[model samples]
Target chain A: MAEISFPLPDLGEGLIEATVLEWLVTEGEMVERNHPLVEVETTKSAVELPSPQAGKVVRTYGEPGETIKVGDPLIVFEVPDDTAGIVGTVPKEEAPKRRVRLSANLDED
Target chain B: MSEHTTLSDLEAAQDNTTAADVQQESVQNFPEPADAGATETMSMQQALNRALAEVMTENPRALILGEDVGQLGGVFRITDGLQKKFGEARVFDTPLAESGILGMSVGLAMAGYHPIPEVQFDGFAYPAVNQIICQVGRMNYRSRGTLPMPITLRVPSFGGIRAPEHHGESLEAMFAHVPGLKVVSPSGPNEAYHLLKYAAARQDPVIFMEPKSRYWQKGPVNAGADAAGYSPNGSRVVREGKHLTLVAWGAMVARCLQVAELAAEDGIEIEVLDLRWLKPIDAEGLAASVAKTRRAVVVHEAPRTSGLGAEVASTITERCFGTLKAPVERVTGFDVPYPSGDLEDEYIPNIDRILYGIQRVLEYRRG
Candidate 1:
């Protein structure tokens, strides 16, 4: 049994949350990667949230009228057992850099 | 007989000393500054221009950029004669793009320069929203301790100027939504002077909004050695009273003060609070005042729906709920699209409107 948890993606620069306008898929449905999963309404305009992984939907965390945070899991996916091992592992070209700095100048104050 | 007379005299002397000490203590506790009745008059626009000049002279690296800022000195002449005085190098004009102005300011700061870019009007600042929200607001964090963008963007905002659409808009909430930026607006000439100096001195990006309609309005400004008016972060109690508290900023603050004066004539004492720093508001001062008064009326020229007044009202309700005598009232613009310039007087909150809000708050009964 492989489980996939998809977090909310970045909508825009200053947008923190969006209103869930409508859901495109139902429970227990299969969804492919990059497919439009939900339509979210922001202060500026309405935007579509895309699926991050290809799998069968196991659970949905929020209702249509609810708002979710940036890192909150929107959906849980059950993928093939064989592909489960590849989900958590980083690709050779995309591995984290050793010298990358994450400290922010804003923290000085 | 001689010993009895001396004892009575000593008791009387002791009582006199105690009474004198009590009087001295009270006077010392509330020492008043010598009131120098001196008045100076200058338009709000002229005051802002003077503030920019003072800051520019104090700091060589401080630069000003905006459409018409260089040659034209702004549509209202707020920056008039600045380019000639400071030279084009320090106060030059920029291309007609707000995003470019904000983005370039971020880059300039990364290269060690303080850029004070002006958005020609409140409505025109929307084009630069992308850069402000993404790059400028988060550059300090994205650069990972490598950069500090100390930029100040001046936006002339609010209605009642009889200008066209896009000219009179209160978009402070949009900028306030960004986490990394500081938003501030000055209500008078005195604040115009000190707040600009404070913005220039600080090492953070600041969006300073100036009320265009109050440009010609005059008030007393300290002409002493310390030119910059007063403390930037602290809230000023323009009018003191014990009844209700009226909170306002920018141009609306003047209207609040006026209402306080008018209310005084009707035997109602009202306290007016000027929130100099919109973000990181002086919550302590406001809450304390509201707790004392037990009634609050928040005022602003922005639309009432989801405006800055809502945030202020919520915070006050949360902090002073136990002491509040009535529900918080707000005097603001209607929730419709900003009306034409001719009808702005009816749309924006005026002195009479604020007085009405105060009366409503005072008349409410708490269960």
Candidate 2:
């Protein structure tokens, strides 16, 4: 398993720091992607931070009412190693299965 | 890593009746993916990451700079885990400015640093065209060899993921037209690994176009420390046949290979030639393959008007005119602004279209 630390993303336009209002999910809990992981209050407004990926929540940084800076570690999740943390949608490989047939090999030995 | 089946010793064997014979001896001489060395199954993304890592470790002067490349490991994560491995200075990020990224690379190259600048996406490269064509392309000639731009500009190119308009574009023709720029795109993980390292070790500027669509597609890659002998100068005969040749690069190469396989079911043998280097194209390789089959069809994601396919078709005609049976057919995208995800199915050439093209060439005859 690989440990991926989720950074506190910029919640709003240029918001530097946010106060942790509540932890929606506690440590050692299962989390689903896009679900509310934590609720934090920025200078402008309070918002819930979604889990970036599905994994087991190993740890969470900052307790309720504590301040955490943006771009800082928000939480760490343990996921299967093959799950690469990427931003875009990379299409899964689907190799077409076909019957084996001997095509001509024109190479002269 | 042990050398994986280097057919380098095999002489340039050409047989008119059998296009497959020249696979052992061709202009674009590289090991077969299965035999490229002690191989490991990896995606093109991982292969490229390994290449960048090796290049950075091998050359102290080498550095990678682009938006999100440092911390996020690039939007596609091609630079994943690199900044952590090599530190921030060598593998760092720049602001979201294509021109600034390329302009800074030019300056870094002038200062004797081998800069590997990533454009983020193919469509985003438009903002840096002035710097790319004017400075990066002409700096060596402008300085009269005093300044050799050893910069490898990595552009994640071509459409298939149904991305927004600018996110996916085949800009090979535009870059290839530039005199000083050497354009090359890898077709698979193995080619991505070898070609990227080869491009990095060059003095001239190389436009290393990575097929964004093929990023997740896995294949065997020889991730060894042997970077001394590989060169991305010519075209590779990926799959050989005697009927007709399917010429392509980037994402289209894989499509053509699939088309070839389907065509084989109909007893039509199609040779697939991966035109790796867009500029300084292996005219010899194109001629040699087409001459054997005496028929050809060029394919690409770019518009047919002046796509790289035109140059390839013209090269085949000029070199193998007498031996050719039919005019080289072009199976390509329509001449319009590349469409968004919804219309990509209609815009990009599908397998049926390519097969139809091959059919047209196969049936054509001189009066």
Tens-place lDDT digits, model 1, residues B211-238: 8767656677654464432345657677
Tens digit per residue, CA lDDT, model 2, B176-247:
999788899999988899889988988788999999888878888766754344455588898999988999
TM-score of chain B of each: 0.87, 0.90
Error of 2 at A21 (Å): 3.4
Q: Give stretches of model 2 more than 4 Å off.
A: A1-6, A10-14, A27-30, A43-46, A52-59, A76-88, A92-109, B1-35, B225-231
| Native RMSD of candidate 1 (Å) | 28.0
**CAPRI quality band, candidate 2:** incorrect
Best by lDDT: 2
Clashing pairs for model 1 are: B44-B215, B194-B229
Candidate 1 docking quality: incorrect, acceptable, medium or high: incorrect
Report the lDDT of model 1 for residue B319.
Answer: 98
Interface RMSD (Cα, Å) for model 2? 6.5
Clashes of each: 2, 0
Clashing pairs in 2: none
